[model samples]
Target: MAIKSFQGARKQQSDTSEDAPFKVSDIMCKDLITFKPEQSVEEVIETLINKKISGGPVVNDNNELIGIISEGDCLKQISESRYYNMPMENDNVEKRMVKDVETIDGNMNVFDAANKFLESKRRRFPIVVNGKLVGQISQKDILKAAISLKGHTWDK
Candidate 1:
């Protein structure tokens, strides 16, 4: 009976640890959508609507992320123009996007990433390695991680 009990405890501990190895990479969205700096805002708006995404990373022809554009940015333009019916021709994404975008490394811990997200008002953040965009970590991802880690204790 003691041996059987020991085996059961071991199984429980293993299961707990398996589910609790929370990492930013584990929760980050790998299937990332991206835009190009040269793309028109109208085109990007269409893509955002069709994809049902808030925003996406902006990459160059060499697939290097230069900036990001969000729904908020689009909305700001509309508000500034007093709801003008003209297409987004004169305005470019590069002009509106946050030039010095903050990024997180993929290998960073989920806790640190979550802290950064909370500290900033930006809805989304790009994940990069060696200055190359690999994926994106959003507020949603951090919330999911936090929920997963709730009421859980880890061994040192």
Candidate 2:
């Protein structure tokens, strides 16, 4: 189906060229490679390096999101371990993960999500459905959604 702004139930007249509101599911990345709390920090870093990702959501065995792990979180520990000449293999992700993660609803409008990005310093948000991790929405995803919406204009 076409993503036209002024069409069907969303055909309300508006001044701006943009009008239709899109949801997070329209642009969120579904195929996410998640990590567990018990997993090693070294392994997570290796995966992030290999996959070319900056971070990933930390989840439990039941697939419930617990925290978020990023390269910034690992930097201090990695440096300290390297200085002490300790084994990085045993350091778990939980030790450095940010536990108070802010998640977003998958049904939220992409515009609202964009505002979140603009107002906050976070690079990405974990999209949740019924309290379970479903997907991820990045700044790039928001930009992509905006570009897709640009092709659609108000009928008025």
In model 1, the worst 10-residue window by lDDT is: 4-13
Best by lDDT: 2
Per residue, candidate 1 scores C-alpha lDDT tens digits across 24-123 of: 7778898888888877777778898999999999988877889889898888876766677655677778876767888887777887877887788777
TM-score of each: 0.78, 0.81
- Whole-model lDDT per candidate: 0.78, 0.85
In candidate 2, stretches whose alpha carbon ends up further than 4 angstroms from where it belongs are 1-21, 154-156
Counting clashing residue pairs in each candidate, in order, gives: 0, 0
* Candidate 2 C-alpha lDDT tens digits along 1-156: 987686557565455434544788877998998999999998898999999999999999988999999999888779989999988886899998999998878888888888998888899999878778999999999888777667466132
Report the error of model 1 at residue 25, Å.
1.7
Using alpha carbons, what is the TM-score of model 1? Answer: 0.78
Highest TM-score model number: 2
Q: How good is model 2 by TM-score?
A: 0.81
